[model samples]
Target: MLPAQICARNERAKAHSSRYNSKRMKVGTGRLRPHRSISAGHNRDDKRMKIGNKSGAVAFAVMFAILREFVMKFVSILLALPLTMAISACATTSTDASAPAAASMAGAKLMAGDGSARGTASVTEAADGLHVLVKAQGLTPGIHAVHVHMTGTCTTPDFASAGGHWNPTGRKHGMNNPAGMHMGDMPNMTVGPDGSGAIEYVIAGGTISGEATPLLDADGAAVVIHAQADDNMSDPAGNAGGRIACGVLAAG
Candidate 1:
């Protein structure tokens, strides 16, 4: 080979090396290396595209965070709804538990000679007078006399501790007697075959308290049911037999 031919071959080899370096990635620091255009078509739009992608990512993150917060708050509210309703229900029940009844009255439980529960009685004050209600049980199916006695004390056994018919005004017993009806005088009670009896009567011009002739005095009052019926014209006793059931009236 000649010297000129060898120089031409070396020149071709150097040109091929330069072309290979141009196609490879550049690793030199920007400040240390001279500025050069990687491609003639490159523009400022590339920087804007990168910035737009970052902005889109930030916006998506912000929206996701807001949605997460909204979902958490909604779930919390749903969880608390039942607790709030339960608290309201408890408050309402407490209010109702404090209230019982709304009537001023008196009551008594009648007991027989053997101390067994026989009946119940109640006295309520109204505009007319003292309203009396008597419910008798465990009694024979027949007519019986029920009267308000003078004393509230109802001794066991005979129940003679309860005095005669209550007469605030001096008068004889029996509604049929002229100028004779006592304050304790009332109609006879007829028991049913089921051993139950009920009677309701309002004593005229009578009162439980705050009056001259109140049914309940310092010693209170007693309700007595006799075994036999009243003759309706009998004086003082009305021929009513032994006291079967007796109860002491108490204010409620």
Candidate 2:
């Protein structure tokens, strides 16, 4: 009787123990499956975040490259502007260096009294006094008295507006006068057969540059040609006839 009872109790105990272990294992497996699913979801989210960061980095690099290119182009343009301006200024300066100077020349263009002649005159300050060179054409081909008048005025017809001879010292008119000799008296000029003549006179007594006998004073002076020859000793124009050709002396 004891052996039979002990065997039945052991079988019952073994069955209960097996059922409890089965239930505990099922619950543990269910919890482990849910944990694995949550881990996988987290890994997928991390991958997506890494991809977004990489895209953002690429966009920033592209913008930086564009900005660098634009800045480089602007800097190049700024550096070339001054060189271009300097070259243009140098070209302008070269053109202004070829003109003639104006301080070494004094001249005048002669107009005829009766519109029958034209001439030119040039005066230069020399070491002695002043040198005058005069050239005339289309005249009457005869002896004519040429004198430097006091006034520069030369009107038409009679040419009486040229005034008297250039007598700054208030002496007599002729070169051989008894009381005095006028500074404006000059030798007679003989025209050629072709109605053209040239005279070059170097003034030794008077001056065309100084203030004493200045040819280019405030009132100025003129070269007047008479119709007749001078007697050289007569007073007041040496008996020369009417005025023929006159030219105002201009200063340079």
Candidate 3:
């Protein structure tokens, strides 16, 4: 009876031990399952982070490229503006430098008068045309006809002739009349009792070139004062009588 009781007790003890061992193994397996799931979730999070960083890097590179292109365009425009203005200014200066300057005639002797008449003439450029300044002294008061005549001849005691009025186009006498007027025909000069006359006006169509027939040529010309006043309409010389005084024109 004692031996049978001992065997039953031993059997009950072994069955309880087996059940505790099985329960411990089940608990450990449950903990290991959670750890494996956590590790897998961490791996997935790492992959997502790597993808986001790569995308952000690509976006930054694209933004930098756009900014660089915009900056280059802006700088190019800034460099060209001043160069255009400088070229325009240089062109204007060159044109002004090529224009003709004023001319003058001094210390000239008259062919007709006994006493020498001192006169001065000047030419200046203007926007519309040329401004001519002429002054004569030691002359009779009244109206005298003044003209720019042809020929440089003033070689005689009598001084009866200085050739004819400078008529390059072979025209007649008149002022502001295009067709038949002498190139030398100008407005009549009125002298005061002081024996001095000054003439000032603008000549619209005149130049100082060898190609065109300039008033002042290589052979030179004469500014002569006639005895009588010009009729202002005569064909040859406006019937302005004889040449009273003559002054030779030459380049200085």
Candidate 4:
């Protein structure tokens, strides 16, 4: 009777131990699954962080490019400033240099007493004296006497309204007068066969518009051409004939 009971009890004990070991293995497998899931989540988080870092780098690069472009434009403007100012200054200097030449010239248009001869005269002040340049056409082809008359009036026919030769020095009229020639006395102008002539004269101690005896004076002056040549030695008129052309000297 004792041997059978003992064998049955031992078998029951072995079965209980087998069930406990199986349950422990199932619990270890569940823990392993949880660890795998945690690892997968960590991998996903790492990928997101890497993507964010790359985006930040790209944004920084874009900003740097924009800033560099702005700097380059600013540098270009700074480099051009001096050239622009230089061009402006050159223009101003050129305008300033041309001021005196425009102010120093005087002009006159001459007409014959009988409306036959016509001419132009330009007066300029040089370093030496006053330069008088006369150009004429439609005049007789011979030696003609040209003089600066005292009065500016050139009224008609004989043109007697224009007074005597301009003698601010109170001297005689002729160049060969010996006592001292008048300031208005000039050499004879010989006209060509085509009736065209030119004369240039520099009157010593005479001016267009200065402190000296000016052609454009209070009563003004006249450029007069005589029909005949002056003999260069006669007293008042120098034997010069009638006044052919006369022009008033006006301030311009």
- Best-performing candidate as measured by lDDT: 1
Q: For residues 1-252, write the lDDT of model 3, one tens digit per residue.
A: 699999999999999999999999999998889888989999999999999999999999999999999999999989988998899999988887897543433224454566454576555544554455668777789998887777765654434456788787777677745566776777788899998887876655554334366656766676677888888787778889877777776655
Model 4 ranges with Cα > 4 A deviation:
1-103
Residue runs of model 1 more than 4 Å from their true location after superposition: 1-104
**Backbone clashes in model 2, listed as residue pairs:** none
Tell me each candidate's TM-score.
0.59, 0.56, 0.56, 0.59
Q: Which stretches of candidate 3 lie over 4 Å from their true place?
A: 1-39, 55-117, 124-131, 151-163, 175-179, 202-204, 210-213, 216-222, 233-235, 239-252
lDDT of 1: 0.88
| Between candidates 3 and 4, the TM-score winner | 4
In order, candidate lDDTs are: 0.88, 0.80, 0.72, 0.86
RMSD of each: 10.7, 12.4, 6.7, 8.6
Q: Which ten residues in a row have the lowest lDDT in candidate 1?
A: 32-41
Looking at candidate 4, the ten consecutive residues that score lowest on lDDT are 99-108
Q: Candidate 2 residues 41-86, lDDT tens each?
A: 9999999999999999999999999999999999998999899899
lDDT of 1 by residue, 1-252 (tens): 999999999999999999877665354454345444544225566877889999999999999999999999999999999999999999989988897543357788999999999999999989888899999999989999999998999899889998888999998778999978998988899999999999999988888876688777888889999998989788987898999999999888
Task: Indicate whether candidate 1 or candidate 2 has the larger lDDT.
Answer: 1
RMSD of 3: 6.7
Indicate the residue-level lDDT of 196 in model 4.
90
